[model samples]
Target chain A: MKQNRTMVVIFLTPALLLFFAIFVYPIARTVMMSLFSVENVTSSVSEWTFTGFKNYADLAQTSLFRKSMWNIFRIWAVGGLVVMSLALLFAVILNSGIRFKKFFRAVIYLPNIISAVALATMWLQYVYAPRWGFLTDFFSWLGLEDLAATQWTAAGNKFWALTFAYCFGMVGYHMLIFSSGIEKIPHEFYEASSIDGASKPRQFTNITLPLLKGVVKTNITMWTITSVGFFVWSQLFSTVTTDLDTITPMVYLYLQVFSTGNTVMEREAGLGAAVGVTLGLLVVLVFVLTNLLIREDEIEY
Target chain B: MSTAKREALYRSRQLNWRKEARLLPGYALLILWVIFTTILIGWVAAASLSTTRAIYRGEVFDFAKNGLNFGNYVKGWNSQNVSVFFMNSLGYASVSTVLLVLVAAPAAYVLSRFKFFLNHPIQNGFVVAMGVPVVMIILPLFAVVTQLQLLKQTYTIRLLMVVLYVGINVPYTTIFLLSFFSNLPRSYEEAAAIDGCPPMRTFWKIMLPLAQPGIVTVSIFNFINIWNEYFMSLIFANQDATRPVAVGLYSMINSMKYTGDWAGMFASVMILFMPTFILYLFLSEKIIAGVTGAGVKG
Candidate 1:
């Protein structure tokens, strides 16, 4: 038993060390950096002046920060609900003895695999292009030409465009999850329900949904985490727009530090770290809260 | 008695009609959605082949005049040194994925099979790691990489990228493989060990083959992640030569003003997008199975 413990430690050490250095240590550093005022990022002497809660106070006052927080919530609410619902609907349909299921599944999942850059570029040129875009044409066909001519990445439309982009990419994975969950439901139950003259919707509500509770919980958790930490997609879709239009907290923080004209400026590192710490805490808080609210007993299949 | 029988038959027919009516809308909605998604993906393929001029003219459905031009592809491949970027991405993604599988497989095996102290904590730790946002790590990682002089050399930077990849990905890969490893029959490993096979040999020869499907799934996922990664590569590999295709395409798009060649940009995107997209097209079943299967057990 002692030998087994030792072996386990040996196997785990490398991964643990890397995780601490790369993941945990950085978070600690972000907190520490947030407390100081650095003249320059690279060569500044570390004079730690403890400013307890000052950064948080400043964050609250910053409109950009507040706007970003609201945007995050908005995207999660709209995107999360739509994507999960559509995915579940599609999954149920595909699982119902449908022909060409594999082909449809492949078509849906294809977008998820495309590189973010490619996907973003395609959307920008083909769908959201101000002049002569397909989406505009479709809108004209629907007598909504004025709406199509409006800038998609603009603040008014940025949220919806970003949400649509996220949902399009996510539907495939979530659909598969829901489909597998549905597949696990025993056929005997459906047969028995039909024997009892229970309608399809009735069986679905009583049997299928109850059986799929675990999957629903899992999907919700996954989507919540992914949505909260969303960075790349936001960056890709919103970079062309005004910085304030769809600036997520992470991207805003990144721009403050790296993309700003002078890296050696007095304002970069400490402020960037402050933003980072705030974002991290927000993410952790959301994750814990969601889990607590949705916590349920594990259902064994 | 005859009237009672007629009434029962009429009731049965009514029930069947109502059931079929309810099913019609569901099937229609599903079919419509499937067709809509198919048309969109088909548009992507057509756009990849069309000239920028044709696309700008909204000739998506009019493929007869502007169909199947290889000019854009050739230009995309040669222009902006994309071939180098492609090779760099291939090298980085392949190496990183292979290393991740190598490091993660044994760790997953030990975590799954043993009942040692800290076992549950280790698993929980990985779950927490999955929630750690990557943005939080970028600053400190930049400092560490610079301090270690990793940024100066390309090969060292790539190696560190692999290590970073392995570190972040181990959580998911280990968890995924853990379930598969645990599901295998214990008797196979026991028999091999009893037959004078060493422990390592037993795992290598017996357990490894048994876990091939899980390994393949994890590897494919890791490959896609490493290939598609953008932010880390953007930060670490500032040089064009060392940049992967994701960053390469970004810079290409950024430089479009100077080039004024929209066709070139679209072509480059198509080139960068093809390798993974084609793999997805062919192996979608495997990919979906891998992801869904992992989710179920997890």
Candidate 2:
């Protein structure tokens, strides 16, 4: 349909304007801000000193930043592996003509609908709390006294506990994605394989795994994005603003830009911007790398 | 029976038998997962109805002895400001979803249907923007909002958050609707044109109604997102009067340290979770479709 220029502009104006204001301007400002040292994000540009790459170099030298970088990498890699495999397994099961498919899918995906704050609080106070926590009580009831006595929320175990909770909350979401992908695979492929007398495991290896490569890529990209933006859960699990055990890059960025009083190390907007930029780049890199590495031509059903 | 038919029936029956026997392991694992997830949420529900004393005594599932206390809900709602936070969350999410659909639909239609010179670039811009996480833009956005003095005024800050919600969601919403618009048959628009309707009028009067399922799906997704959105709201709408349920609930948990109102805290979580939980119970298909569609299609 040929459209008038005025009508075209009218149709597009609100979206374009909002996009520029909310996304484009802020992102551009962030890039510029990262090159200069500013005390706080709200400071005037005139107060910014040209710090060049000092902020990035400083970040490299800072042990906390290094620790956070390692923490995020572990979350992305370790959590990605666990969530993806479980999601795939569940998706495969649900697609195998199982009973209660709807009930099971909903149960798995229930955590995705709840607010992150509430889920994290539930995990913190209910599941991991030393006193009367679910794990402690369950293990003790199971007669595993040594396991029951373990302090899940203590600094030694807090990071893993946080990752475990985060992974639990995420599995349902990724499972849904995998289930949808599996649903699209025609039953004929499985039927033919079964007719050929291939074992169930063999059929999965031959048909299911290859077919799910694309969905796996999507899951990995999504996991990368979430892993990089990890914040609220970290805050809930950490004792202080700058806890080394639970802090991710996003938490570090928040502290650098916004923390005040005793929580404040120093308000360094430039460094925070650098952190944001690095995190953004890390996500993009993963996306591109995953795409490159997993270049299997998707089979169109 | 004919020999060929008898053999075919036997083969099919054998296949069914093998499938059933092989699925036992899968069933076991799935049941374990279902029980684990369900019990966690169920335990929370039970605790929300019990007193803090019973909860401390590890009587979470012991309803008869603990005596279900409905007062926790009343106290949480009235005394703890959950009602206020719930209302704020509802208002923001609904308004943002409406505004998002309003702005995104027309743009998506134009981008998908018409061939403007800049169409491809604009489309790619949105797709690229999807990869840019909110954390990247947030600090600068906060700075800008603060400089405008929007932080001091509750209403303006709320409005700003709605705007932010709409803006951040536009890329996904538009891209989502783009596929819907493109997949739609052009016959309706052609018929509308023959009947003397203008293009803009056609979009509003005819095209939109045809895409109702997609519109509803995307809007539900937007509603769930903005309702649970914490990070941006924590910065922009941090005031007690304006905080959404996500931030509100976080602060409530922190305050439990002083008050020791653990039951009230659980009740507050239930209140915060109730809307999305109910929505999920009723419209799970839409939620699943909206979420997975974004991932697989992209």
Candidate 3:
């Protein structure tokens, strides 16, 4: 399969050139853009005023940015907790030799194939609609009048409601990942345990969970990345361009760059770039930490 | 066999009432979740065929009374421009998938099969690129596109979106196909070499066809992604003529607030999802494999 130098160059040039033009260049430009105070991201560089760390300092001072940081952290931490547990539970149940497993798996994974914009809109108008919405009806039927009375889309509860819907769409995708990981474990392990007269719960704890450590780590890393990219659902949930209730770092970055409505007094592409830099660093940080902590080499399974 | 052995065998089979009962809770939970997941999409389908008043009044499932109102589809397609967006998405997704495969497959072949100086770093770069969020580069990328004067030029913007789609997907597609090419046996190439074929010819005539399944899987993944991509198109192809289904549907929903044609909006949503639904119906296995395979191995 070995090829000579000329063939290698011919084969690799297209992808390398594309990688540089689209990804490497933009990322490099983003980092550099963050260091300069530019009027418009599209403006010429001669008009740029060099600002060293001032954008980052301004971001530190901005309360909305602080709120956005907190919001994204919650999404990563809180939403991560919910999605991981639910996806794992579903994966385990389905992998435990259930009937109609394929049907259930497909139904659960259906949302993942649909556009986020469509899913978010469906959640907003159908499930979270003020009056005869599914949640309101269900809660009222359960006789939890107080819960039914609360507006799910209101400023206070919109974040949690958005998180729940997002997690609902996401769980199936992660569940499929877990299913594949669980499927890889040889059936003999379970059979041997059962023959040894071990309880099902005991077998799951001792064998299934340990074997799935790598999958769990993968799921966590993925959850972190998706939460960091949370934008569409936030935009769909909020009526305004930049609502504090659902503003993630992505939305904040968008508002800064686009400067729509009364949100941004001036176009601060530098601050927007700074936000990008921060989020980018956060992803790299999580990735490195996960790799260090997970220690894939330590587990044979 | 003794009665004790028979009893042990019966116990191991998990056919007893108590063992079956143990699975009941799990089944119940799964059934509840499945119902919850399907109901929203199902209701949307029904709503798309009902009157807007019926939907507003929560009679979406009351088909016996409200019956089917087919005008919503006509309205969405013609008046609301759903057809334009649908065609735009189909074109973008198809072209992008082809471009992605064409660009990524050869690089993957080289990276997986050849001994190159920057092989490790190149592969590592793609892996790292996957972890970085798109929002990181998007703002600056927007700047670049604007600087290129592609804004408001519908065809050029559409082309920009296609190029961006291919670029964003190149890393994952390469990595996905890399594993496929690596797992391929070396004998295929050796045979082609012995037959007096050049390496590029061998790749084009032999290896490429052999890797059809992997290429198909990667292409389907790209197609679905580019079709469903929102943020990028919302920025790049915001023009009426160039908007894809995702952005088009978003703006349609926003306008529907004033128009009050809720059923038409739902119809647009149906139009938006129909292609993917049809794809999923026929190619569920491929979609699932492409999605979960990329996640698991990568």
The best candidate in terms of TM-score:
2
DockQ of 1: 0.42
Cα RMSD of all models vs. native, in order, equals 5.2, 2.8, 3.2
Candidate 1: segments with Cα more than 4 A from true spot: A1-10, A38-47, A141-151, A239-242, A262-268, A295-301, B1-23, B60-64, B257-260, B295-298
- Which pairs of residues clash in candidate 1, taking residues 3 or more apart in a chain or in different chains? none
lDDT of 3 by residue, A1-301 (tens): 4446778888889899889988898899889889999888787668788999999999999998999999889878888888888988998999887777888888888899898988888898889877757888789999999988889999889999998889889998899888888898899999999999999889889888878878887888788888888998998888887799999888887787775565454678899889988988887788788888867646554
Candidate 2 lDDT: 0.87
Q: Tens digits of per-residue lDDT for model 2 on B40-98?
A: 88878888999999989988788888888889999878876778888999999999999
TM-score of 1: 0.89
Prediction-by-prediction clash tally? 0, 0, 0
Q: Between candidates 1 and 2, name the one with more favorable DockQ.
A: 2
- Please give the CA lDDT of all the candidate structures: 0.75, 0.87, 0.86
Number of the top candidate by DockQ?
2
In the range A1-301, model 2's lDDT, one tens digit per residue, is: 3466777899899999998998899999898888999988899889999989988998998888899999999888898889998988999999988777988888889999899988998888888878878899999999999999999989899999999999999999899988988888899999998899998889999998888878888888888888888998999998977898998998888777776664546668899899988898898899899899988774666
Ranking by TM-score: 2, 3, 1
Q: On residues A151-198, what C-alpha lDDT tens digit does candidate 1 reach at each position?
A: 886767877887787788888888888888898888989999899999
Model 1 chain B: weakest 10-residue lDDT segment is: B13-22
